[model samples]
Target: MADDSNTEYLLDASLSDADAMAYVPDPVEVPYPDLEYVSTPETADTYDKYFYFHREDVSFEEALADIRDCDSLARGLNSGMGYQDVYSPYGGLAGAAGGVIGNAIAAAIFGSAEKRRIRRVNLRRCMNFKGYERYGLEKDLWQRFNFEEGFSGEAEHIRQGAIIQQAKVASGPKPATEELGR
Candidate 1:
């Protein structure tokens, strides 16, 4: 039987000059496609553009109905009761007299004011629903490319540019571009 309990291992740490200068593959460069710039027409600046959308005229009856609806809602908010007469605590007859007088005064003054307020509210609601409110023009423009008949390409370009410019301005200042050689 052979005793193989004291085996030792050795490592080589020497390399030739040719082995030291081993070959390394060169990095390949990728070519990118050139971007082509198109000049916008001068007429784009001169053209008058307006965002137009289809809006039906509201009739007197429609306005009246809206006013009535608002008034009814107001009445509901006021404890489901119409205007109540003011009461005096001195006497029943005096209270009745005061109530009558107060009701007359309110009808004469506040009645018209209340009606006007309701009408205004109704008008605003109607305009909002019919897409006639403020900023509606811009909203209509962005909604679809369905421009009016005989609209020129130059006008469209100008309008789109204006919208883009407005959006950029609203978005605040952008980060500065970095220089190649600093």
Candidate 2:
């Protein structure tokens, strides 16, 4: 009789005992210079004298909130969500059917919306870039805005007041001489 006893079989040649996972190299982190390392004398002079002249009037958070509010408003307006037809149905149909004339009329109606959107987008980007440069906050504008409550002028004032109060507390009381003049 043929040997019926089961013999141990070798593993498939393609399957190795060792781990077959591909090597993954570690991620390389590029170093970014700190503000002091990057700032030139001229840039510092301009920033302090010109750009930040009104820094005390508005805190970073307030400015950021205002930027957010403006951005939100711009987005809402640009979305054309609430637009209503001003023209009668007949006029609308005529305008739509007028070929090149219709196209011109449509452009005239919507061109301002496009312009406003572009302006708002640019303004938001500028604010974000400026905030990053001034504060050394690693987050981009949208990321920073995510941490704040929804924008409101009243809320912004309250926040600014709180910030000012904190600053006063952190700095401690002014001397009698310093207070005497004010």
Local distance difference test scores for all models: 0.31, 0.31
Tell me, by TM-score, which candidate is best: 1
In model 2, what lDDT does residue 105 have?
A: 64
- Model 2 scores worst on lDDT over the 10 consecutive residues at 173-182
Model 1 weakest 10-residue run by lDDT: 3-12
lDDT of 1 by residue, 1-182 (tens): 12121111111113232332221111111111111222234422312231211223533234323333432343212111235766567768888888777777766665554544443344345434543321112323222322221111213232222222222221222213211110
Task: Give lDDT: candidate 2, residue 107.
Answer: 57
Compared with the true structure, model 1 gives a TM-score of 0.29
If scored against the real structure, what TM-score would every candidate get? 0.29, 0.24
lDDT per residue for candidate 2 within 113-172, as digits (tens), equals 564445444444544454322222222211211222212122322223322222222222
